[model samples]
Target: MITVLVIGIGTGSPDQLTTEAVAALNRTNLFLVPDKGADKHDLATLRRELCETLIDHDRYRFVEVPDPDRGPDAERATDAYRAAVAEWHAERARRYAATIRDQLGSDGTVGFLVLGDPALYDSTIRIAESIRDDGRLDLAIEVIPGISSLSLLAARHKITLNRIGQPVHVTTGRRLPEEYRPELGDVAVMLDGSLQCKQLLPKHGDLTIYWGAQLGLPDEVLISGRLGDVIDEIEAARNAARAQRGWVLDIYLLRP
Candidate 1:
């Protein structure tokens, strides 16, 4: 049987890994870590370090899979985004299939180490789904959850995620409109290529913003204040850090 485990490691921190996640890591005969190319090696390196720290299996084979880059393009007619992602996923599944065949001999356990929670803003589940579509993963597929970026932000800041009777909306920064706000309570924005908060509060601002870059890393940066007060600084700092690191993974929370 082929047991495929999707484990969430959570934000660059070894401590962020839950007990169950660690157990799953040790149980896997194969580990799949995606190389986001040269630009984002830190991400892949972090996953490697986590395994080195928590896993002590002699037969634990590590496979660095290549990610298919979805270039900058609009998804207009023919559902370009869906098609592009499908192609990318199929390529990933092919790689996974080859790895499975070579490593486990068609029946063993493998773990796909995903950053943060696999179910949130992560495409690993999709890739696993692709593997399933190919009828490759006949073994039990287990999802081991871990701390998420939002949880990390809340824990680091010592704040609750939402008001007593309020709802929180988690969304990508790309979908943000010209004006953004916490509809009824709070909003957690991720995958922010553009500073959605800045665009929303261009000039007029009266909201509480909590931001974090590289959330759980050593070079982590956090800023919280009135939106109008720190928007420029946040933009400058975010830009500088992106230049320094070549890329940045960040998320922010807004409450009103």
Candidate 2:
């Protein structure tokens, strides 16, 4: 049986990797890296660099797998999204099974390195679930948590996530409402491409925002101020960065 370790390496920096995560990588015999086409080559390269820099073991083998793109389809229901993702994950599980059987021949420890904490908006855990659904993965699975972009973003700006005893809401850009419930203390929004911040400014009060793009990366962009004062700047910056890199990942925190 193959033992699988779903380890988080944090955002692009090796310094962000926890000692336990590094140790898990070194202990594994096989390392799995996912390639999401050219736009994401840097992501795969960063993982590769982490292995090269941190792991001293030469016996550890690396495997690169191409990910399937789930076509553009609206998922209004949770089951709809789950079904679509399950199909995508089924294909991925087949690849993983084939790789383990053909490449490693079983009885070895394998690591699937995730960009951030596996539980937070990452599909690695779902893929692992797919593997289990098929009864193909009979391995002992373990998870090693890493620093998340939220943690990094908050730390970079030197701000706590919430006000005293206040409830903080974490949400994605896609599902965010044009108007938010004013009772939430702080909103840490992620996976946002819609510029939801702009829509919320009309309802703004003492709202201040600390937003960061490409958190923890060299080309990271950060901005903060009254939501009304900086909404346009954030939009323009996001567009420019997207055009510059051909891709962009950003997150923001809203507090009052």
Candidate 3:
């Protein structure tokens, strides 16, 4: 059986890797790195850097997989989006299965470094499930959790994710309705390419936003203030940072 370790490297920061995650890294026979092309080459570079810095031995080999494009049509309709994502995941499963069969030995261990915790907004788990269900390859999956970007954002901003006994609502930028508000407690937003905070500012003028981009990495940016006060500044800074680095992984928390 091939053992697959879905290890979270934690926001591209080697230091954020837990002891268990490091141990998992050392046991890896192959590390699968996804290449998101030139515009997002920094991500691949960071993964390579982590391997170079953390792995004590040279037994592990790195394999680069070209990520499938989500396609422009995916955004036009809900059904189209689901179909496109499903197709992309299928392609990923095929690639991963082929890699396991060719690059990994019968009992070899393979690792994929996730950005944050494997269970949070990551498709690696889903892809692994697909590969396991196919029955083409014997697989044993292990997950090693790491620090989440939301946790890092909260830490950097010196705030707690939840109130005294309230719950925290986590959602993506696209799924966040314009009328959404944190009536219960705090709200954390991720994968927000549209700067939904700006849209929320008018309705939630009293809300406070603690935002961070590229957390736990050098050149990280953090902005915190009343939504109305820092909306323009965050927008400008986000645009500049994305232009400078060619990519951004940003998350924010909203509290009333």
Candidate 4:
């Protein structure tokens, strides 16, 4: 049996690693790093940097795991998009299973570092569980949680995720229109590049938005104001930032 530690490393920064997370990194002798193509090369670099900075021993080795493409993040309908994502996860499971069998021994311990908490928007845990369910390898999985981008978003902006006693809603950009209304209190939107935010401005102009991109990195950007007042500015900044950096991971809070 192998132990798979799905560690949450937080947004692209070494300081975000919890004491437990750091310990987990050092405990594992092999690290599986995800390669998200040229556009996301920086992401892989960040992961490498974390291992280099935290792990004191030279005994650990890393293997690059290529990401299976799930196609463009286009504006697809819910069912179509979900089906596409399911297929993508299946392919990833196949690759992961192959890697585990080829690289890890029955007694081996390997680690997969995910950005933010594994329970958040990340799919690493799901992939690992799927691999285990396949019966190709006996995998004992452990999840180490870290500061999520959502948590940092609120921290950077100095606001709580929810309004006084009001509920906080978690949603994706695609479902924002259907799931959120100005009366919903505080809504945290992820997997949205502030692109889907445009659709909401037409009806909820008075709503305020607290947005941040590259939350923990040096290129971090924050914009907050009335939805109608700053929507254009945010859109332009997001596009320009993504163009310059080749990638951006952002989260935002929409408040009524």
Comparing candidate 3 with candidate 4, which one achieves the higher lDDT?
3
Which is the winner by lDDT between candidate 1 and candidate 4? 4
Model 2 misplaced regions, further than 4 Å? 73-79
Tens-place lDDT per residue, model 2, 145-216, is: 989888888998999898788988998876667447778779999888767777776678357989888778
lDDT of each: 0.81, 0.82, 0.87, 0.86
| Residues 1-256 of candidate 4: C-alpha lDDT, one tens digit per residue | 8999999989848899999999999999778887788988888888989899999999877888898988865667778899999999988889878877788766688899999999988888988989899886899999999899989999999988987789988988878877777667888999985568788777888888999988898889999999899988888788877998798788888898
Sort by lDDT, best first: what order?
A: 3, 4, 2, 1
After superposing candidate 1, which stretches have Cα over 4 Å from the reference? 73-78, 178-182
User: Candidate 2, 249: how far from true, in Å?
Assistant: 2.0
- As for candidate 1, its clashing pairs are none
* Each model's backbone clash number: 0, 0, 0, 0
lDDT for residue 213 in candidate 1, whole number 0-100 = 88
The best candidate in terms of TM-score: 4
lDDT value, candidate 2, whole model: 0.82
lDDT of 3 by residue, 89-128 (tens): 9998988888888897577998999998998999998898
**Cα deviation of 211 in candidate 2 (Å)?**
0.8
TM-scores of all predicted structures: 0.91, 0.91, 0.95, 0.96
